[model samples]
Target: MKRLWGTECAPAWRAWLDRATEQIFRHPDCGAVERELLDHLEDKATDLMRIFPGLTREEAEQRALEEMGAAEELGEELARVHSPLVGELWQLTRFLIRAVLVVLAVECLWLLWKFA
Candidate 1:
């Protein structure tokens, strides 16, 4: 987490990023987006410190998060671009599909066990 600036900035940065981008993406995409945003935040914090000497790491990260805008606004914008139809329907669809596949696999395994 602090591999770049020698500061534990990841916890703060990730907390904010998760609150910001959590609802915009699905499982894998959400992890990717979080990593990307964390990298950006770390880079921004480094840049801020470079630009203004005397700025602490925490100060730089806070400024960067503020500059990134409110979480709700960013989340909504990302949701619009990534999933225009971000709702329970998508969640339900994925859940149902997985559930059916799991049930089928279980049934197949049961049949095999019974036959054997």
Candidate 2:
């Protein structure tokens, strides 16, 4: 998210973590308790690596990218909960894009639909 958002917003991100923990604590579901445990482990690992600041800049960028990928997955899960239609639309768009690419490739090979 830092790449899509901004690197300087890490403090804001920290605040988000606090809010999420509070939400989990308030949740009535049993699975949320497990999520809280997992969140605690993840935060500990992140803080562990963060405290030993000897990694190179390149390594740091790679770590940030990995973290962002995980965050994007989390964002998708949250989006699924709030706006499932948006998620469905994004899925449909991706499917159509792949179909178009496949159609163009077939046209390039023979200028026709050989299979059909």
TM-score per model over all chains: 0.60, 0.33
Residue-level lDDT tens digits of model 1 in 47-89: 9999999999889989999888787777777777667355457
The whole-model C-alpha lDDT of candidate 1 against the native structure comes to 0.73
What is the per-residue lDDT of model 2 for residues 23-95, given as tens digits with 9 covering 90 to 100? 2222232134335534554564466468757865445544544554454445445534545455567779999
In candidate 1, stretches whose alpha carbon ends up further than 4 angstroms from where it belongs are 1-9, 84-116
Misplaced by over 4 Å in model 2 are 1-41, 44-82, 111-116
lDDT for model 2 comes to: 0.47
User: How high is the CA lDDT of each candidate model?
Assistant: 0.73, 0.47
TM-score winner: 1
Query: Considering only N, C-alpha and C atoms within 3 Å, which residue pairs clash in candidate 2?
Result: none
